[model samples]
Target: MSNETNAILNQVIVLLNRSLAAYLADAVPWMGRAGAEVGESLTAMVKDQQQSADRLAEFVLDNGGDVAAGEFPMSFTALHDLSIEFCLKKLLQTQQEAVQYLQQAVAALERAPLAKALVEETLGSARGHLETLNELLAAVH
Candidate 1:
């Protein structure tokens, strides 16, 4: 791959990692752990999402792309500090950010044949996260 392509992929990895950390931090203390069975399920969902993020990071690194280590979008912090109930809203916001990031990442990958497969694989999970978050939010609202 060209140097430009590699650099962009590295940036995308970093962005994904940042999004993952923010969302995971926001969703701590699952609803179940807070004495609500529903919270437990949410907690499980968070864990799964975390795993997916890890996998994406790993994939990026495997391709010689470093995960982006940076601050989440400014909007994530306050909600990250809130309780699980309030945090569910933050999770929805996070998924929205992930979708946006993934879209850009995929667009970048479109030029790098070597990096395309990894980004495509990650795209599937990112899209799934968006769908799941939307469904959960619908139920909550």
Candidate 2:
């Protein structure tokens, strides 16, 4: 993998980790029973993101690149002052941003079939998340 490819993979890993943490921190608290269900769904999504990160890390290692470690640098204000509709919209936006990043990573990994497939799979999952979020937002409105 080229340095550019490695950097892109690392950025995706960081973004995935950061987004997982952010969703857990910001979105989970406002949910009730529905929130619990959503939390469970988010947990599964986090696991998927982790698996993607692990695959990217493996690719970095195979290419003799150092895997990025430590915190992924997530920060978000709580949705305390916001309406449920607003919060859901913001969460949907975050999911869309993640999908965009994964798509970019997939495009960058065109030469690496396995890595590209892994990223594409994760991108598909993110799109599913966006669909669910859209449904939730519609319900809130």
lDDT of model 1, residue 69: 60
| RMSD in Å for all candidates | 3.8, 2.8
Q: What is the lDDT of residue 43 in candidate 1?
A: 54
Clashing residue pairs, backbone N/CA/C < 3 A, model 2: none
Please give the distance, in angstroms, between residue 57's alpha carbon in candidate 2 and its true position after superposition.
1.2
TM-score of 2: 0.78
lDDT of candidates 1 onward, in order? 0.60, 0.71
Q: Which candidate is the best by lDDT?
A: 2
Q: What is the alpha-carbon lDDT of model 1 when measured against the actual structure?
A: 0.60
**Model 2: per-residue Cα lDDT over 1-141, one tens digit each:** 777777777787777777743455444455643666556666776787788788879878988887776463334545544444556677788888888878878888889786688778778878887888788767655
Question: What is the overall TM-score of model 1 with all chains considered together?
Answer: 0.65
Q: Evaluated with TM-score, which candidate comes out highest?
A: 2
Could you tell me every candidate's TM-score relative to the true structure? 0.65, 0.78
Return model 2's CA RMSD, one decimal.
2.8
Candidate 1 lDDT over residue span 1-141, tens digit each: 456666766665555556633455454534434435435545555565556557656766676665656566666645544556566666666667766776787787786765677666666776776776666556655
